[model samples]
Target: MVLLRTLRGPAYTRILGIGDYRPARIISNEELCRHIDSTDEWIQDRSGIQQRRQATPDESVVDMGTQAARAAMTYADLTGSDIDAVICATITHPYQTPAAAPMIAERLGTKNAAAFDLSAACAGYCYGVAVADDMVRSGRAEHVLVVGVEKLSDYRDLGDRGTAFIFGDGAGAAVIGPSATPGISATTWGSDGSGSAMISQSVSWTEAQERYAPASLDMPGDPARPDATVTDSLWPFIDMQGPSVFRWAATAVAPLCERALAAAGVTAQDIQVFIPHQANTRIVDTLVKKLRLPDHVVIADDITDMANTSAASIPLATAALLRSGRAHPGDLALQIGFGAGLTWAAQVVQLP
Candidate 1:
């Protein structure tokens, strides 16, 4: 029997830097209300979103992700050659075969680094952070680029009142590398697949291709199909059971956060910031009350301005806090993300 040598890495890992990209196009509640039957006040009372960003038609998921990744790398004082791996978390990449990570890696000029995509819906960014932290500490990668991006405009249904005004397009990224002291703590994450249907696309890709391909293939000016009209059903749009999701998030997620804090061996008073998923203000408020967090802990409310950028929410919120001087380097932050898949991930970290 031959003995194999084992690889070991650093004692700790920290997020070296963070970045995000918000598209230039801003869609206010008044504008969104023009398409849906909702009023701006109603939308605000429901989801606390006054506006959101939507990428242009030419902006692909890779494009937004690459820009965000570049920003993160720049903040970390790193270049493509320094990245050993890239992980992109997204559900709206539009392609199923070729993942978005490698494309982002190519755009960044990475030197053949390991790359892949992750599909954890809104919980994705936090999931990527956990994975990157492990990879760095295990010596699998020296520096890992984790990007959470979503071009949700492609899947938005203006006619759907429940979700039409709830989503936005954006990208956020982080660079994780070795640290002298612990910066990332144990992550408390889990999923309840039983509630998977609470938030999802109206149809799978297979269903869309099989059901709508024949009609979609016809030319618009074809003489035989001069009156052809494509309905919203021809493409998959976001479908969500709002009440159920809100209930689960408001009630169940607080305990998960408690576990994360406990796992980190810290109390709520030790945290300087609380960055929860920018899903809804009501949910955030409920979690705050349940956790009994003090007033000094700055809670992120980026949802009011950014809407739900799915996986990009936490990091984008983090970046906002940093820019506004609400959060500082080495400050302890407790972050949690939960959505779709009824998934949830929470962790405590020292902000970069």
Candidate 2:
């Protein structure tokens, strides 16, 4: 019989640094009102969003992710060669074959890092963080780059009022590495497929291609509309059942957060900051009340200016919190992410 030697890692893992990229273009509620029959006041009252960022036509998910990754690496004092793996969490990467991770790694100058993409929808960034934590703890990788990015504007339905004002484009990245003390705690995560339809794409890729078949390809455009094209009909858009999602997020996620706190051996009193996914301001308010957190715990409200960036929300908000000096190194933060797939994940960590 042959015996194999095992590798040992550090005592725990911690997030070394964090960074994010908000698009240069801002789309205010007034501008969105032109396409949908919504008033600026009604939009603000409903979602607590005044404006959101939108990337230009030329910006791709990789471009935004790379910029964010570079910033995180710089904050961690790491170069491209220092990364042992890259995990990109996004559903908006256009290419279905080659994943976005390798492209980002190569662009960052990594010659041979393990790379892959994760599709957990809005729960993706937390999912990536958990996986990276495990990898470092197990000695499978020394340093991991986790990025959450989305370019939802490319698939948005301007005429659909339900989601037109809810989504924005952005990217956020974090570097996870070995630590002397425990910085990341046990994560509590789960999913419910029964509510999967609550949020989803308007059509499948096959359905979109079928709609663009030759028989329907050559239809004449209205004489009054010279800019109309066949490609417009083939693009899939995001769709959601707002009430159902709100109910799930507001009621169900609170208990999940409690479980995460318990798993980390901490209570609401020990946390200094709370960064939930920036899905909506109302949702954040409900969770805060449900958790009964003390007044000193600062809750992230980036939704007012950033809208919902899906997987990028938590880290983006984390970066904003740190930049504002509301959170400092070694401060305890409770982070939770929940969205499509009815998926949810939460954990407690010390701020970088």
TM-score of each: 0.93, 0.94
Model 2 agreement with the true structure over 261-341: per-residue lDDT tens digits: 999999999999999999988999999999999999999988888899988988899999999998887899999989999
Give Cα-based local distance difference scores for all models.
0.89, 0.88
For candidate 2, the TM-score is 0.94
- Deviation of model 2 at 13, angstroms: 0.7
| Residue range with the least summed lDDT across 10 consecutive positions in model 2 | 221-230
Stretches of candidate 1 exceeding 4 Å from the true structure: 206-234
Root-mean-square deviation of each candidate, in angstroms? 3.9, 3.3
lDDT of candidate 2 at residue 110, scale 0 to 100:
84
Cα deviation at 104, candidate 2, in Å, is: 0.4
Residue by residue across 264-333, what tens digits does model 1's lDDT show? Answer: 9999999999999999999999999999999999999999889999999999999899989999988999
